[model samples]
Target chain A: MSLDPSFVGRTYPPTAPYQVGREKIREFATAIGATDPAYHDPEAARALGHPDVIAPPTFPVVVTMAASRQIIEDPALGVDYSRVVHGDQRFAYTRPVAAGDELVCVNTIEEVTTRGGHGFLTTRTDVSTAAGEQVVAVWSKIVVRGEA
Target chain B: MELPTQTFRVTRADLVRYAGASGDFNPIHWSDRTATKVGLPGVIAHGMFTMALVGRAVTAWAGAPDAVVDFGVRFTRPVVVPDTDEGTEIEVSAVVKEVTEDGLTRLDVTATCLGEKVLSQARATVRMAR
Candidate 1:
């Protein structure tokens, strides 16, 4: 089934605040083999001007992915999760996400289209501090393959 | 104009760890049965994981952990990992695309696995470390 273009510009409510933890950042950094000291040591991070341990550039995906469920699970959208393949991802950061920060995501459907009998869904997630400070804007595009 | 190249090894264990860390416990990344059932050759690394590895390379090049200001990539091919101890390898390399007057350095990044490009239109902009 093709994606409904009408879903474009649809915005979801902000997710509950997620407290960033130092252990989570360290785990993610280790999983990706990022050996940077700032990713694990708070002092190293502070030396680089961050308040605490800093997450990698793509770390926001760990949060935005769950936030995006609000859109993909919408019955009106008709997305087949089994057939979804990530197409593109991008991030623009106002600052690094530091451990101990409380973050919330506001999701928006930026585009929807059909090509080659497949559906493409694009979403933009605005991540901000619980206090309303913007941290990053993340964009993701997924292609839902048509059944053979 | 050219930055140093960095290589990362991907293993089944690494995928498992990443899945746990990232909360992306997709069976295709761990279960060979599920992967074959889904038409994938075998277990495949998450595209986000691959992107994160490249992000590491970007920050290393910029010489600071919080240097990245913008980053993007298109997943062109899957980085298929075998069920072996050695798994596979991905090589990440970049060249300076441009340096803005505002202290941002743009890089044209490339990531390849098994000699095939895995990410396209890969680019990053980083704030130079003072």
Candidate 2:
């Protein structure tokens, strides 16, 4: 099934604030084998001018994945999640995320198209501090394989 | 200038840990049955996991953990894991594409597994060391 082209430019409501945790950042860094002291020790992070342990560059995906449910699960959109495959990902940061920061995500549908019987959906997530300070912009593209 | 190449091993255990940490419990990353049922060759590494590894390489080249300003990649192929302790390896190398007047360095990165490119159009921009 093809994604509705009209859904392009649709924006979802801001998600509930997610508090970035030091231990979570440590865990993610460990999982990725990022042994930088700034990822594990607050003192090291402080020396680097961060308020707390900073997350890896790709760590925002953890928060955005959950927030994106609003768009992926939209009944009107009629997406078949089982047939989806990731296509592209991009992140532009205003600042690296740090522990104790309260973050929120606003998801917007940037593009929707169909080519070669596959549906291409692109979403842009604006991650920001609860205080409305912009943090990063995350973009993801997923391809819905055609049921041949 | 070309940066030193870095290689990281990817095992099924690593995939399990990444799935838990990243809150992406997609069975295709861990369960072969689910993966095969989904038309995949076998269990596969999450694209985000590969991206994270590339991010590590980029930050290492920039000489800072939080140096990344922009990063992006296209998932051209899956990094298939064959359920072995030996697992697989991803080799990451990059070339300095540009150094901006504002002290940012742009890199064109490449990530490959088993001599096959897994990511395309991979790139990162980082704060150059002062």
Candidate 3:
């Protein structure tokens, strides 16, 4: 099925608030093999003038993944989840994500195009704190395989 | 161990090798003219590849490459690798910021290109060996 052009500019409800814990930040950093002290040590971050342990920029993926459920599961979109691959990812940040912050995500379908029997879908998630302070915008391109 | 500040002369070859190792082959990484056409100053390195190098620096510092518990970074700016005789060595490094009660290690990371930051507001964590 073709993507719904009408879905362009559609916005999903903000995801449930997620608290950014130092340990979780640490876990994310470690899982990706990062060894930055600022990710877990408040003092180290404070020395750099950060209020707390600062989360790495990619840390927003946790909530972004949850927020994307709305887009991938949209019955109108007709995306085959089984054949999807992560084509690309990027983030534009207004500020670094810090620990101890409560944040949520709002995802918007930016574009949908099909080529060579493949569907290319782009999703942008605007991530921010519950207080509405924007942290970053994550853009992802996913390609779905054609039906055999 | 005292943290080291790194500066690299990254050649196009380095970027290609990185793509091979990381499984990220975004054309923007290898095609110079394509990169210029895309409004980038020049070909830039993948943000994740930069993150991976920084991750390597951190894990090496932690005394175990596989001991890191988590790592992530945001791409604030793109590292425009210039097309020159040599290339670019992404100035990627980390500073030990703190150690938690549970003994997790935290480090603030930064990667720069030609004096401009490519990945900013970055951080990582490593679990120390007992």
Candidate 4:
């Protein structure tokens, strides 16, 4: 099924607040095998002028993808997950994510198209704090295989 | 196990195995012909695969994978995997950047591919076990 081109530029409701805990950061770091002290030591992070432990830049993907489900799972959107593969992902940041920040994400369908017999869905998720502090913008592309 | 930093020679074979494991068969990653068509010297490794490796490196330090909360990086330059004489061994290094009262720590990272900065201005946060 073809994605709705009209969905392009459509923005979804903000995600529920996700508390940025220190342990969560560490788990993610561990999962990726990061060993930098700043990822676990406040003094190390403070030496760098940050308020607290800063999360790795790519950390937002956890929440970003969660928020994207609003659109990807929309029955009307026609995106078949089993047939989809990651195409691309990019991140632009205003500042590093710090612990203790209660963040929210707003997902937007940036573009929809068909290429090489695949359905392409591009999305942009803007992440920020509930207090409205801009964190980062994540852009991702997924390709759904042609119907069997 | 005490977390030990790894420094290995990044070979074309290493990159291919990574692509296979990650399910990223992007032509630019393993096909020199495709890379040349796109103006790269040879194959270019997937940015995410590198990121994955970096993540694994950090997580290994923490001794638990699920403890990481967030991680991100910028692709400063492509890590062109040269086929001749084998590929270059890329070096990845990270230092503590910041720590919060909540016991979360952020890391400043640098990854060099063939003596050139491939991933820069990287950051990650990890929560310690309480």
Off by over 4 Å in 4: B1-50, B54-130
lDDT of 3 by residue, A1-148 (tens): 3566677778888888888788777766654445668776889878766788876555666667667878898887888775665565666666667887888899888888878888888888988999999877888777786764
lDDT of 3: 0.71
Alpha-carbon runs more than 4 Å astray in model 3: B1-130
* Interface Cα RMSD in Å, per prediction: 0.5, 0.3, 9.7, 7.6
User: Comparing chain B with the reference, what is the TM-score for each candidate?
Assistant: 0.98, 0.98, 0.84, 0.83
Which digits, one per residue and each the tens of the lDDT, describe model 2 over residues A27-142? 99999999999999999999999999999999999999999999999989878999999999999999999999999999999999999999999999999999999999999999
Candidate 2 per-residue lDDT, tens place, B1-130, comes to: 9999999999999999999999999999999999999889999999999999999999999999999999999999999999999999999999999999988999999999999999999999999766
For residues A53-122, write the lDDT of model 4, one tens digit per residue.
7776567776786688798799988998756656666666677788888989999899999867789898
* DockQ-based class of model 1: high
List model 1 lDDT by residue over A2-81, tens digit each.
98999999899999998999999999999998989999999999987889999999999999999999998999899999
Task: Tell me the lDDT of model 3 at B65.
Answer: 32
- The clash count for each model shown is 0, 0, 25, 58
